[model samples]
Target: MRLSMRARWALMFGGLFLLAGTALLLINYVLVNEIVPQAGLFVSNFAGGPGVSGGATVTAPPPVLDKQFFQKGVEGAVDTFRASAMQKLLIASGIALVVTGVLAALLGWWTAGRALRPLNTITSTAQRLGAESLDRRINLDGPQDELKELADTFDGMLDRLAAAFDGQRRFVANASHELRTPLAVQRTLIEVAMADPTATPELLRLGQHLLHTNERSERLIEGLLVLARSDQGLVSRVPVRLDEIVDAVLRSSAAMATEQGVTLASDLEPRVVMGDSVLLERLVTNLVHNAINYNEDGGSVLIRVGDRPALLVSNTGPEVPASAVPALFEPFRRLNRERTASRDGAGLGLSIVRSVTHAHHGIVYANPNHGGGLWIAVDLPLLERTMTSLSPRPGADPAISRG
Candidate 1:
């Protein structure tokens, strides 16, 4: 049977006690029965010996001492001594075994718990862990034993994970910025070509199409950079109104929604949160844009907000499978597997939304609408204090920073 560590220790101590007690008892028994009273036996034999004469056999007169009685006394003394020693040994062993067994059990339990304390710490650290909180460590203090080595190994793993995430974020940011410069130049050239007065109808159409494609590429690159930055960590926290941010994003997206013949509706209750306003605004914008972009003609979008710093955006559009809803938040994952030359979206909208939500320590969920379209909800921590002064404008340039 595989006993627990504490149980094993207890059994070990108990076995040692039993073995030592048995050995000591046997030694005492042997000495009392075999070695002691040898002098009394010699005296009894000398006194009881028959006398021998030359030629004729002669019997010696009985000694003054009662030989039989004296011998019996000597034998009785030895037997009594042996019996007394055996009784005392048994009593002492019983008492000692009970007392020491209890002490051993207690000590074993305490030692086992103390030894496994670091393991418990490691387990809790692993349980509470997430991608953003990779800096947490067991940093166990004490002798460099096996448990300490295990804790140190776990801390090293976390260090490696943190480094990998940082490297990935850096790569994404650099690539996005590098991609944006050429895209800007391309947009400028295409605009100049579109401005040419003598351009044929086909040339004008081609220039307009190129401009749209370049814009979509720019949006995709920017979304990637934003997603990377959000994953890196939140840099600053300021009071932000969910309603105000949503309203602002709605305003920016108003023209696009109108052009698409999508109706916008909102139930913006006062919901204030503490986070990076730019990222929060971007998050809302992404959700709203996705809702607007993937809707049917004359469809409607409902934006609802609550005091819990919660927001839910539901829209009417094509039927979305429940199984496919989760993959919608992945970067560059579109509903259509066949990548047609559609500039409608670059498919990073929901992905950016999810990243920003995570950076702010929030929960986001998505459900496919009953008939058609998608429903997205986000919940963030609410700020306790109401703002009396005007908040800073959220037009700051996006930048990646170390956590």
Candidate 2:
């Protein structure tokens, strides 16, 4: 089993105590063994030993001198006493050592838990955080130690991130508002030019082409703005009927699908998601539009809305590689040379879908179709957490930015 840092630290503490205790016990045993023998413990004395000759009485070197000896029974008794004493010492000390070691282990566990509590706070905060919640801070309070420093550093990083997001939101807002006015003026001029009765056929055709290009730019800009808005965050939470939105997208996409010889089909259940209504509509529209536009002639586009995933859009067209699936959602990142040649798309369809999903705190992914094309799945929650109210954009829908 994989051990957590706290567990490993606790075990180390317990092991160290056991090691020291065993060493101390060994030293005590050795000391008692050596000192008891020298202390004359259980010594006994006797008067005589066998004479050197067969019948000679026991004698000393001189008349006044005497000799002492230990009987075999006396030596045996001393050995037995020492052995019993050593055994008792070991038993008593062993029990104490075990008890203390257990206590040491419990103390170590508690100490480790306290020391690592800050890390748990950091982990939980990181897990709960997202782009939308970058404003959150750890603000961990304690002594000015390593953990506190880490928390302060983390808070600083969040501060910088929140500022950056705010700046990007501001830039997108200003650019969208400023740029839309001129484009609107150009569109007016183009329309007025095309309405002239005196205009020649070639002039009319040129005007029409210019008008088409201008509209394409407008859409590209609009898609970009929407992308920024979604990236900034989800605006609000209202009960949005997802199936109804898909139906509306399908109706609007009917002409494009017909022009491309593609069939638009749907199997939508009554699924209501908690998200911005405009964002939800844009997400569905982008998917349906991309599906129809990217498919082959006489191919089919299917939109399925259900409880689990919320939305699924699949089409039959070009064969996309497995390795290229990740790039599909990236802004302006398209597969194949033909993708750049598409006239209607600003190449922000899937990108917009991604941003919208992120704003709603949902999951979006895609896989290459078995035969051809791609299948995209958007998984959104039917309910959402508390959301903040966002200020409305002056003259357009929720706009997006490039960052």
The candidate that wins on lDDT is 2
lDDT of each: 0.78, 0.80
User: For residues 328-372, could you state the per-residue lDDT of candidate 1 as single tens digits?
Assistant: 888878886544545656778888999999988898999988889
TM-score of 2: 0.80
Candidate 1 Cα deviation (angstroms), residue 214: 1.0
- Please give the lDDT score for candidate 2: 0.80
How good is model 1 by TM-score? 0.65
Number of colliding residue pairs in model 2: 9
- lDDT by residue (tens digit), candidate 2, 276-392: 999899999888888887889999888887767989888899999999989888888778745555374778888999989988889999998888999999998765432223222
Poorest 10 consecutive residues of model 1 by lDDT?
394-403
Using Cα atoms with residue i matched to residue i, what is each candidate's TM-score against the true structure?
Answer: 0.65, 0.80
